[model samples]
Target: MNNPDSLTNHFLIAMPNLADENFARSVTLICEHSEEGCMGIVINRLTDLHLCDIFDQLGITPDKASHANDVVYLGGPVQSNRGFVLHEPLGKWESTLSVTDRFGVSTSRDILEAIAENRGPEKFIVALGYAGWGVGQLEREITENSWLSGPANQDIIFNLPLEQRWKAAAQLVGVDLTTLSSEAGHA
Candidate 1:
């Protein structure tokens, strides 16, 4: 059994052989875990949309004085229409969920408003949708060697350029993603 506290605020880095499209070379942050399986976000996939576009659709105006470009990310497969923000620690919103000491997840418009006003967390990546697992599903994957869990790094999660995050996260476990083999072997 994984220690409840230990899995909290950790990254589940997919192994070289993970074949699932949703998780191949993916870096998932375990946010909320309970008897109800696990829920997290893929921190590295960037979407074509921008944060400002989302705000515009919601009729929220970003602060003109702030450098108001919000980084949009591909959160996961579930609830793709909803927005989730994985951000650096800062001004807390009522719905902010602390993933770790350095990161948190907020799904509230109030937090979005703060972000638009430049009064939100210092660093943030806005994601659409979220990845979810059924009870024991994640554990089954881990047992099958589909992932290698590691401590979450804020630099990789919040600070690194999106293009470099996947490689950087894979490097945390000393594996070069380019050299990885997607085929599962049974020798």
Candidate 2:
């Protein structure tokens, strides 16, 4: 569960000036946020791997309905070897973190098995790793203008082309990322 004011179900848009290689111009979906910590999945960066490759690793045979060729994403820098499935409709799964009534994240093998059989959630994206911040860390970075937070938009996550996501997420909050100066200065 998240606090009412928490960023749990929001999009974390990295400001243009954020030069970190893993997060530059990235859009992350905050899945779990509370006094304990914050965890998110970066939606805009793609890895060279595909879903079938992962199935092979897990020894799950892909069925015809399995969209095994779909590209996988680099969710974040943490747990880079583990797989996560970010899906809509919040279906019942063995191990799922319900981000919201409509969205959930599943790390259990059962969801992956269902996906391999094409019996998984209708809308989903597979990701490896996840972005994480310790207690109060994300807030401090946000105060420093490293990110812009806004309500999560499903279209951007499951529909839009990758190149357009960064701008689209920021646009949802009426922040024209293009107009912001990239230079950071502190008084």
Candidate 3:
């Protein structure tokens, strides 16, 4: 059995051969991983929606016009209407999963309200939905070479542009995915 703790707070960069339409070339941040399963958010898939659109839908008036155009990501394939706020300088919220000392994922409307009111964390990426794996499912996929994981970095999550994040995350483990063969090699 794989150590569940090792998967938490890491980035799961999909292998080039990952044929799943939902996860091709995706970068996912594993927020929690345990015997029960694993949960993560795809950080680089931007949707057509904006922060302002979400705020309007939630009936919260956005306080920062500068942030109105911020992209809202399609976190994963589950709960597409649900919001997940991945942020830093972790703070107490109505419902939050503390991913690390410096990072967290909040699934509460309160956090959304705080962001709209300009009282949220210093750095954050708002996503809708999240990726999930059933018990042993992720481990099996990893063994099949479906992913490459490395310690998650805040800079890549919040600073890098969406298009660069996939490659950047892969590079964390010294992998230039472009140079990798999609076919698995046999010795």
Candidate 4:
């Protein structure tokens, strides 16, 4: 079993039994990784806030009302006050983290402006925070089977609806999450 790249730009779908308050049933997209630790965003955790809510706070009226329903997500337990966008590469920005060949992260405000203007990346999800692990903490969790990792499917990341992402990612690995049990001590 080879160790997964800390910066693999993939998704970690929590197993059904993952009761951790921070990541249960969450889908995290790895952003940056090194021997020191790892950082990522939870793609499926929708927040009570919406893009319009942020736009209002910024004094920017959206060009159209179509974005009114956009839901901001609680990306992770870290940096809950910050905003980050994990999106498809549509237009370049001053700050962007290429998680994988297909996924990228842009934290700069310009991207958000573009989104408010109705001209942002083709596909994106707005998140309020991000998930992080210190040094070997992630490796320990994986060894303990708290999560099931796999290559990210672009469609699942961008196209699938929120509630379905977990099962969709699980299916990518050919396991039915519903059949997964939380008992780790079982043989």
TM-score of each: 0.87, 0.96, 0.95, 0.91
* Residue lDDT tens for model 2, 43-157: 9999999999999999999998788999999999999999999998899999899988898999999988888888889899999999999999999999999999999999999
Name every residue pair that clashes in candidate 2: none
How does residue 118 of candidate 2 score in lDDT? 81
Q: Please, what is the whole-model Cα lDDT of each candidate in the order they appear? A: 0.80, 0.94, 0.92, 0.83
Q: Which ten contiguous residues of candidate 3 have the minimum total lDDT? A: 60-69
- The root-mean-square deviation over C-alpha atoms between each candidate and the true structure, in angstroms, is 2.5, 1.4, 2.0, 2.6
* Residue-level lDDT tens digits of model 4 in 104-138: 88888898888888788888988998999998888
**Which run of 10 residues does model 4 get worst, by summed lDDT?**
1-10
Candidate 2 — which residues are off by over 4 angstroms? 184-187
Best candidate according to lDDT: 2
Residue-wise C-alpha lDDT for candidate 3, range 70-179, written one tens digit per residue: 88999999999999999998998999898987789999999888888888899999999999999999989998999999999999999998899999999999999999
Q: Which of the two, 1 or 4, has more lDDT? A: 4
Candidate 1 local lDDT, residue 181: 68
Residue 123 deviation, candidate 2, in Å? 0.4
Where does candidate 1 clash, by residue pair?
A: none
In candidate 1, which residue ranges exceed 4 Å CA deviation? 1-6, 178-187
Residue 6: error of model 3 in Å? 3.0
Candidate 1 Cα deviation (angstroms), residue 175: 3.4
Q: Judging by TM-score, tell me the better candidate of 2 and 3.
A: 2
